[model samples]
Target: MTGSLTIGTLAKQAAVNVETIRFYQRRRLLDEPDKPPGGIRRYTQTHARRIRFIKEAQKLGFGLDEVADLLALEDGRHCREVEEIAGHKLAVVRERMTQLSKIEKLLVVLVGRCHGNSGKVRCPLIASLESATA
Candidate 1:
């Protein structure tokens, strides 16, 4: 490989579309190579790898902004800072899980009530939602 990959080829190597690469460039998450006079911009395997890194981070629930931060610290000299970011993300995930669990429990109880009171004039789930909002 001659490090002369076109954007389309780079996207293919990274398993993303060309527009995804463009969007990352727009967000400053990826660099936009300069095109020479009357020539096209090119990409390389490094660019593809960077796109993969962004995609994997997203898979682990990091937002684009967080990904940008991680990218900024990618020189391997910011381990502690990286850990702090990961720790904060873990805490947020835990809190969200706790909230979802409570919602699940409430839904279970409401669903059971609805089943038990089938054919009633009002649905227990609907009543619960209306009262909660009120």
Candidate 2:
């Protein structure tokens, strides 16, 4: 924890797989430390922090592309830009919630219909899905 961390240690500390770290490196989301001739590459606490930041951002519904934008605006001076990005993400989350709620309601009705059936008959859920528009 005091000295530089190897890639495996960094991955463990960052709660991500080694492949994920490489993916982030390829995406330019994380910096790839220089390799010393025959020496292994090592990461710093800063890199660990950045990985955590990326993961947290993704948990809040930001995709990698959006996470990149968030990373770019991470500097304290970009408060307004960050807000704009967050505002957009909020709108997307709200819309997804609305869609999910609608789907939940439909599933409840369809499941209830199927559950209430006492005899062997056609499934209401299948019928509904077949008749569903769009």
Candidate 3:
């Protein structure tokens, strides 16, 4: 707290790995702080917060590019644009859910056919995948 924090300190506070912070820097999602003369660069709490925000956004299925747009909206001038972006993301989520449900149904049927008494030569899971492609 006396001086600015180092990358390790920022990573610890953000609850992420040091390499993750570096990756964010490389991706331009987080800014690299300037190093002082004969000293290492230090990150402020804002950097830690931004890293947390990016991680949380990713957990919610937002890609890095979308997270960057969300960060822009956090700048207080793009409040109105957030809704449009979120709506599009919701539509995408719904589509993925539909696709996942279809996959789940197929997996259920495939698993049901595996009576566990058959030899490995007749594996239903492999059969299902092969048939789908054919």
Candidate 4:
């Protein structure tokens, strides 16, 4: 909020770990500034906002690549294009939710079958996975 922030301050303001900020820099999601003479790299309020944006996007299930595209579209010129991307992401999310629901149901069934069983048999979860692979 004052001058540029150090990495630790930025991470604290963004409510993220320092390593997460470093990871984002390595992944090219966040910009790394040039270090001054004998000083470490400094981050700005913009960098903290960007880190928060990336975390929120990820929490919503957007992949880093998709988040990058979303970030690129934040300039207001690409509103329509951003809408299209969001729509596609929504469809993908729905499909994944459906698949996960099915898996959850199967897991519930498997747990029920395992209750009170004393035999040293193979895990139902592993068996189900193997059968699906086949």
TM-score per candidate = 0.59, 0.59, 0.57, 0.57
State in Å the error of residue 9, model 4. 0.5
Local lDDT at 89 for model 3: 70
The digit string of per-residue lDDT tens for model 3 on 41-86 reads 8889889889989988898688999888777666655545768876
Measured with C-alpha atoms, the lDDT of residue 46 in candidate 3 is 87
Worst 10 residues of 2 by lDDT: 125-134
Error of 3 at 92 (Å): 6.2
lDDT of 1 by residue, 1-134 (tens): 76889988898889999999999999999999998989999888889889999999898677999888778777554678878876777687786566556667778776777775667543354554445446
Q: How many pairs collide in each candidate, listed in order?
A: 0, 0, 0, 0
Model 1 segments beyond 4 Å from truth? 75-134
Better of 2 and 3 by lDDT: 2
Of 3 and 4, the candidate ranking higher by lDDT = 4
Model 1 TM-score is: 0.59
Task: Evaluate all candidate structures by whole-model CA lDDT and list the values in order.
Answer: 0.81, 0.81, 0.77, 0.81
Q: Candidate 3: which stretches are off by over 4 Å?
A: 76-134
